[model samples]
Every structure is written in C-alpha cells, then in structure tokens.
Target: MFIRNESFYSFRRQYPIITILVAIHLILFVWMNFLPFGNYIRALGIGYNLAVANGEYWRLITPIFMHIGAGHVLFNSFSLVIFGPALERMLGKFKFILVYLITGIIANIATFYLGGLAYPPHLGASGAIFGLLGMYVYLVINRKDLIDRMNSQLVMTIIIIGLVMTFVNPNINILAHLFGLIAGAALAPLFLIGAKPYYAEQRVFVDHGEPVFDPNRWQKKRRNNKRLKQAFWIGLGILVLFGLLSRVL
Candidate 1:
C-alpha cells in the first residue's frame, strides 16, 4: 500500500489532496527560508504558547503548515506523501482534509493550554502526520477489512518506530504528537465509516497520452525501489533499538 508506482502526473491527478499539501509544505518552507520577511512569517505561524495565550488564535491552524527547519518540514512532508494517498482516497478529499486540520488544531490547542510557560515554541506538520498514523492504527485494530495483512503489519511497525522517535527526539512537542494520535484515532470511526482499502490498480493516468509504465523501465525502477525500501525499513528497525537502549541504559 505504501508503494507509489504511479507517474508524477498520474499521482498528482489521483491524489490532489496529498499533492496540494506537499505543495503547500514546499511553498511555505521556501517562503519562510528565502524571502525577506521569512522570519516574520515564521514568527507569526509558529505555535507559541505565549502568543496563543495573547489571543493570537490563528496559531492553532498556522503551525500545521509552518515548519521550523529543513528536516522538520521535509520529514513530515515525506511521511504525508508516503501515507496520505490511501486515506485521501478512502475518506474522500473533504473528510481527509478535515481530519488532518482538526487533529492538527487539536494538537496546537493542547500545546497552548497544557504547554503553559514550559513548552517551547513549536511548528511543523508532525502533529498532522501523527494524526494520519493514528488513523491507520485504528484501521489495523477495528477495521481489518479496510486494510490488508501486510499493511496492518507495516502500520504496527511504523507505529512502534514513531513512538520511539517521539520520545527520543529532543525538542519535540510531545503533547502534539500524543494528542494528535488520540484525536485521529478518536475521529477515525466517524470519518472512515465508508472508507475502502487502497489498491494499486485503482487508477493509473497516462502521461501526455503515453503509458507511464514501460516494461523494461518499470523493471529497473522496481528493482531500485525495492532496494531503497529494504534499506529504509532496516534503518527504522535500528532506530527502534537505539531508542530503547537510550531509554534503558
């Protein structure tokens, strides 16, 4: 389910919600890093507890699109790209965006209230990304028919890795990650009522009227992609170990 063999144009056409979200991520990242008022824009968007307490309520919504650094935005955006399409298809565009935004806003609200004076200023799509993860976890638990065995296992593994990283990483908004997960899981039943599992054969658009998959080219790319996926999983496994050891000894 995680593999995206579709062409760039094809993927964009099929998953406009993911496409628009990634585009917003990139655009906002660039805007906050390159333009003259970059710092000003970032300051206005970050989930600063002080600012939120001062009645800057938009901070609740803005931080979902406002990342702190290159790694922050890119990692969250990559996770969204990897995992979002299925839900976008299952929930349809409207519910998908609704879950994302609501869960993110909930996380920011927690950061505002529970955070108080101790919480550092925070910004990133991590909350929303965790929200998506939470939805998948819900599918794995309560809606087995909506997900295959392989994806269910994969979701379990990813959830473990995400939990490890959430605790291990310094400067993380623990409230956002945990609250977002809860909110998504809580909201999943409502939003995923009529959702269906994603399949590779659903739709494959042609690139400018030409087939996107050529036999030989497809084989080569698949082989390379397999290797990359293997390495990625191994790396994540190592992270789980490292995180446990760090906490234990």
Candidate 2:
C-alpha cells in the first residue's frame, strides 16, 4: 500500500507495477517478432472462442500484456505513462494493481462473451488503460475535492474522446473499452473510501533547524516499493543487454 503522495514530475523512484508491465510488454513484443517461438507467442493472443473453448483461460489475463503492433503498443504505453502515476498514488500500490487486474480481466471477459469471433484476435492494454481513466472519472464525479477541476476535466475529455472513437471506428474493440470503463467506475468505490488527493506541488517542511525527511510507516512502505521498482528496472536492463548482445553475435 505504498502511495508516494507527490507530484508526478516530482516522483523520484520508478513506479513498480507500471515499470514492470511496460518492460514485460516490450520484452514480449521483441520476442514475438524478433526471436524464436514468434509464431507460438502470436498464437497466445486471445481469441474469444478459441481461448475459452480450448481451455486457455489464462488468455483472459495474458492478452492484457500483448499488443498487435507498434502503433498499438505505443499508444497504450503512452497512456499508461501519462495517467498511471497519479492514479497509482491516489489508490496506493496495492489498490492500484488490484483495480488494474480486475478491470483488465473484466474487460477481456466482456469481450469474450460479447464480441464476434470473426474479429481479429483481441490484444493490448487499451482496456486496462481505459479502465484507469474510468476509475479517474468516478473519482472526479464522487470526490471532486480529491482532484482539481482542470485535471478532472482532462480525464473526462479523454473518456469522451474514447467513447466517440469507439462509435466512429468499426475496427475498435468497443466491447473491451466499454466494459473496462464500467469495470473501472464500478470498482472505484472500493479504493476511494479513505483516499486522499495528490497534489502536483511538493512542499518541504523543516523542524527547528533540519529539513524533515522522516520515514514514517507510509514512507517506509514507499521505500520498500521503490527497492522493488529498482529491481525490476535492473532486470529489464539486463534482459535488453542480453538481447542486444545476442543480436550482435
């Protein structure tokens, strides 16, 4: 439950879940295209009937990490980078991860039950990103004090734009987006009961003569989370280096 209550810009440590997720996606993307077992990884993509009927129920979760192409992955990654930290801080690490997984799985399930099997294999983090946006919208609606008016409007505008795109584009996975949004909003209450608003402004306080940098319970939790975050990034760096070395040799 480590929630770094600081501005996104002021955030010093890498975000644990977000860093690991993006790294995993990038690694998988490279594996699915550049390395062996490319075909097998592509086959792992979620197809409604194919996934469920074949007893590959894990597709419900795995597809959240798979993207169809460069454009698709970039868009979702950008969205996560843009909005994730703020929401993560608000909900705390535990709740933020819980909301993400729950909404993502729900979105996939919705697609599985409602989508036409004729459509291309559904893959990407768009659903989960939409879910995060939806959760923000819920926070804006129910707890206006937790977010400023401008930021709230920005979130609402994104949702509005997404809704419009869903209707306008035939290729879009409207069911996944819709379900993700609903899932995010529906699950918001569970994380918001005692949530505090995060401010983009950082304040420094001093007691007597020294600057206050005390490690309270929450700060200790945050420190531990940061260590985990660093570990993931280090692992990602090593993986990338190995991949590069292999390519060279």
Candidate 3:
C-alpha cells in the first residue's frame, strides 16, 4: 500500500496536498541550507524552546517545514512521499492539510512544554509523518474495511519500530513523536467521517479506448506483494540511516 508507483506529474495531479507539503519542505530545506542568511532562516523556523516560551507562537507551526540536516529532511520527505498520498486521497485536500498541520503543531507544543527548562532546538516533519501512521493505526483497528490485513500489519510494525526508536534515540524529539501520534489518533475519527480508501486509479484511468478496470488486477496485486516487502525494507533502511546520521550530524 505504501509503494508509490505513480509518476511525479501523475502523483502530483492525484495528491496535491502531499505534493505541496513535500514541496514546501524541500524549498525550506534549500533556503535553510544553501541560500544567504541561512542561519537567520533556521533561527526563525526551528522550534527553539526559549523562543516558544517567549510567545513566538509561530515556531510551533514553522518547525513542520524546517530541517537542519540532510538526513532529517530526506527521511521525513521520503516518508511523506510514501505515506502522505494515501491519507490525502482518503481525506480530501482540505482535511488532509488540516490534519497534517494540526498534528505537527501538537508535536511542537509538546516539545515546548515538556523539554525541561529549555528543550534543545528541534525541527523536522517526523511528528506529522507519525501522525499519518497513527491515522492508519485507527483504520487498522476500527475501520478494517478501509485497509487490508497485510497493510494493517505493516502499519502496526512501522509504528512499533518508530516508537521504539523514539525512546532509544536521544537525538529525536520524543515528546513530539508521542504527542503527534496521540493527536492524530484523537483526531482520526472526526477527519475520517467521509474518508475512502485509496486505489491505484491514476494509471488505470486512461483517456482513450482502454477500459478503466484492468482485467488483470490480480497479477498486479501479486506484484504489489513483492513491492510491499521491498518498501518495508527500504523504509526501515531509511529510518536506520536517519537515526545513524542524526547521531553523527
């Protein structure tokens, strides 16, 4: 279910919310890394605990789009690309964006309130990405009709791995991850009021004489099983890489 087989243009047309969000992440990453006054931009965007305590309320929201290291931004962006499209399709554009921002904000708020006297400055989309997993978790338990058994297990595994790493890795904002997950699960039912499951329709929806429903979807499903395994390993690899890089960079 997490495999993104669609082309860039096709995926963008199908999932504008995900596209726009990842775009903002990439742009902000560039501005905060390569451009002039990069440190100034980082200072403004990172969720510095002292800044938030002093009533710089925007820091909570800005941190969602800000990142300091290559591993940090790329890890989050890879996750969004893999998982964001499904939720965006399920929730529609407006609701998807709302949930994304709300979860991220909650993550930031937790970081601010619980980081002792001053939490080390932190920024990344990890919280929001976990929020997406939290939503999938809700579906796995309550809305079983939306997700199949394999995908359900996959979601659970990812969450377990993530939560374990959140505790084991001191570099990550643990509160942010935990609170973001809580927020997402708390908000899932309301946002999923009219939600629907995502189907790989982009490739099948042709303009010409070809039929919309491919007669050989079973073959595709078998292929996707292999893809699911590959995606799982790739995801775990990225998370491990990010964790290692976080320690180093």
Best TM-score goes to which candidate? Answer: 3
What's the best-to-worst order under TM-score? Answer: 3, 1, 2
**Model 1 TM-score on a 0 to 1 scale:** 0.83
TM-score of 3: 0.93
* Winner by TM-score between candidate 3 and candidate 1: 3
Per-residue lDDT of model 2, residues 195-226, tens digit only: 77775323355766645665585886567557
Best by lDDT: 3
Q: Please list the residue runs of candidate 1 whose C-alpha ends up more than 4 Å from where it truly belongs after superposition.
A: 200-249
Cα lDDT of model 1 by residue, 153-223, tens digit: 77678778888688876677889999999989999999998777776345445757644645576786578
| RMSD after CA superposition, every candidate | 5.4, 10.3, 2.0
* Residue-level lDDT tens digits of model 3 in 179-248: 8898898899999997766763345767775757789889988998888988888878877777788788
Who is ahead in lDDT, 1 or 2? 1
Taken over the whole model, the C-alpha lDDT of each candidate is 0.82, 0.72, 0.85
Worst 10 residues of 3 by lDDT: 196-205
**Which residue runs does candidate 2 get wrong by more than 4 Å?**
1-14, 116-119, 206-249
Q: How far off is residue 191 in model 1, in Å?
A: 0.4
